[model samples]
Target: MSATQSYAHSRQQKLVVGFSQTPAPTTGLTRQEIRDLSLKGVKTRAASTAGSGRLHGKVAIITGAGPELAIGTGAARLFAREGAKHIYLLDYNPAPLSRLAEALREKYPNTKASPNPMRHSRSTVDQDGVLDLAVSALVDQAIQEEGHLDVFFANAGIIQRPPKRVGGGGDEIAEELRATGRNMGGIEDTEFMEVLRVNTLRWVEAGSNISYAFKSPIHARPWRAETLGIFGLSVFLGIKYASAAMAKTTSNKTKSVPGGSIILTASVAGLKANAGPIPYSASKAAVISLAQTTAYELAGSNIRVNAICPGLIETDMTRGAFEMARMAGKEGRMGVLNPLLRQGLGVEVAQMALFLASDDSSYVNGQALPVDGGLTASMPYIRPKL
Candidate 1:
């Protein structure tokens, strides 16, 4: 066999042996216990957890923090462990959010976790307006209880699939594209717009004229759309409310500082092509732009805005790809595009989030930092024997 094939074969053998198809009871632990231990090991080894009161007395909000293995959930747990006074978890799905909140409460008794469902039953107004009300209410509650807002992690997003077209020229083009495993051209107008709306704009409220008059090359535009059938919130609105809450002076603390950290979840796809679907990539690119622009707009206020661009992470969102690779015995091939030569876990991304959310990244602002294991550091090229 060739050197490449030999290496791949060796790796595959290791994977097969290292991870058993089923947990062996010889370890003297239940299946769930083993899973929990593995998770704890990953978190412990990923970074130092020496308690230093990094976020003591700080109130924070994290969206998309519902799933057990999601990046947002990892961040919420990290923040709680690091002494965050309160964490408000928001997600479209209430069941998972509530379960996550309960888990956090059990794991970290000192930290207060509130699971909030970002859903609205009212159809009287634009769906965006309903979201605006829901967000506003959450922020208000955080302020009323904690008296200060410290961190806002805008990590909620969706990887949209274009609906199958029928009986038209567009449908023909879509079929051709799908045959090649490309769906960008097949995406419908409404679906494309929905991705943009849910991924980029954070709708404040209907008929409310909010403007950013600061003279910078970047200009903020008013986004108005009838709530499409899809429902999800975006990062722009998080910045809008979080920044405002961060700027307020709280009576509980003397000599209060008007500054906080806002972390937006972007992706490696946003930084380069072929990393994700067109709409998802474009939306993430907009997120990076929002980070840069908002950092400037909120300048001198001590509120740092930045984006985290993750590469190949094994989360619920990307679990299908991982499962498929494993089923095909191509797990060793996963994440080979990155220098790490392995897939990253959500806790790994959570470490970066922790740094940004804490005072450690106080000087970092308006940057799109990639936690992609140096994938974007260079072009795709095979290593040469020296």
Candidate 2:
């Protein structure tokens, strides 16, 4: 069979296997019992048949699955629900990572899920050797286990804490400005450089090294040399490398899957000013641009590149913000600016990532899709005229 045909046939077999393993639905529960549970806001896993198995037979990798209610963990759960064959999860913290893997296994017994603890240091990002060793090892592990990688979710990220003086209160706006100033000083500040190195440059390094996994030869080596000289190691490198990886054909002709999808976790901060701290917002803005430009570069190669710009989602990263609102008895005001008038869940953002990963979004590319509940639609000062 031709490679394309083999790919289709393999996917069909995997889907059938998944369907056969689906657990039977509960039949004895009465309508009233179900309603009571629903009214109580009881959460349940999606039944295996809940979705159309959009990611059937696909191999996926999710980085930064740290917090229990994190985007990476949410994506992993959703991917399994959508019938991804194998998921390789990475996180800096071993405790939450293992728990996420266990949760996936219990929910989707037929799917293969593994947790890996990998930490990336500042030296890892700045030094080529360290970055290559870390990123290449991840790609290699995925390939070794599944034989091919269909989707990569670069969801790992860090946010500089708001200044202590700015503790979540009435002075939040002013305190936030102070925090931004402290984190993002003059362009030459070492602390500012550190934030850039972790948030931006590391992504570029990982994206570039991941391209090697697809057996792509860097024909324009001089471009890297020239651009590095000009841009001085910015987020552009990650986009450049990831695009190259996505655009290349499989070195092993026997492997059925060739081109794949990449999903970057940007933020609404990237779309509008003051949404986040200065350094973070700037890095995410770069990520948004990267998604758009790379999608254009890899147009015909069957590789789709996209980004998810999330709004105020509850996670470890936002614990402080959430906690302060709760303490002030103003939790309801958390996401009042958005039309939804409520904060979002991690699963909501993950659902968007699932769309981009699956064939459901095959025609969608180069888009910085916002899962922010219409928050990015207008200026913050535009009040509803009552």
Candidate 3:
């Protein structure tokens, strides 16, 4: 057998042995112990496929990869480890963007990493145009440097805690009120609009720009849309533009596989009420709907669209929430509502994205897969006397 085949065989053997020795945790273990085992499973899988090259020779663009532990950065890191040829990292902050780019380069010397600092503000048409222009420039740079773009991860967004005028004051006040288990009032119109603009409108604009680039005449081959995963609450617009973009086909008579995938980062809030703020929950609900509707619409075109609803994940955006819970001596209660009984990490979400991005999910599409430890399996409430 060839070297590549032999190596793959060895890796398969190792995985089989690993699974045999570490069978799925049973109910005999404590919930915490089970959660730890679940996390260990993820780590083992990652290590086993450390150099598997799932994305070999593919070029990708990942936005909102600012925080080191955020989902976007996590996806970017995993993409590189999986053998993406080149990656263009975009973020509003230069520091984190540079830091992530540096780390990727250090670890994956064969992969090219470029960092771009682009802000997403939609107060004015001019500002919106700026975002469009920035996205266009980044896509252009990727094409110029790498010759083609395979994956576009539109994962940048902002989560607004209701403004003080709405009910709670600042973030601290909001967290304090939430800790006391009091629901805040609706957010002010201005605050709500701002949040919608940044979280929704901006993503639509960026996704369109990237899609346009993919259909541009400069690219010679039929663009393969691996995964267009978006992060944040703006699942509606994110899925809309991304699916539309992926569905666009080249005019050339010759046909290729014509495969594409759109993965939206939805939240458990979208699946049920009482999981998040009013506006946030509403937006996520729209996202889930978009994923289903778009998947149906694009099925004929060989493009698959899906949404991933995550439960309590510990990331930069949720740092405050996690901190508050820990300070209240309820740290272990973070994801107690979920069957897993523990919070998830960003990489866990990345693993799901990778699956949706790869050919393994070619037959799977148009579904809102939940990676929330079975949080959405049933209506969340106290079990009454049986």
**Which residue pairs collide in model 3, if any?**
none
lDDT of 3 by residue, 144-185 (tens): 454444566656655664434444455674554553343445
List, residue by residue over 1-386, the lDDT tens digit for candidate 2: 55665665554444334332333257565433433343234135332237568898887767667477788778888898888888876556766766777778898887777554243211111112114354556556555555677887877776663345634455764554446555344334444445555555542332332232223432243334233422312234334444444443446553355578888888999999878877778778878887887677666777777989999987777876777777787665566456544577787788899989988888888889998878897544422245
Model 3: lowest-lDDT 10 consecutive positions: 121-130
User: Which residue pairs overlap in candidate 2's backbone?
Assistant: 204-238
Where is model 2 poorest over a 10-residue stretch in terms of lDDT? 121-130
Per-model TM against the reference = 0.75, 0.71, 0.71
lDDT (C-alpha) at residue 378 in model 3: 52
**Candidate 1 residue lDDT tens string, 266-295:** 999899877887878898999999899989
- Model 1 misses residue 263 by how many Å? 0.5
Q: How many residue pairs clash in each candidate?
A: 1, 1, 0
lDDT of 1: 0.72
Ranking by lDDT: 1, 2, 3
TM-score of 1: 0.75
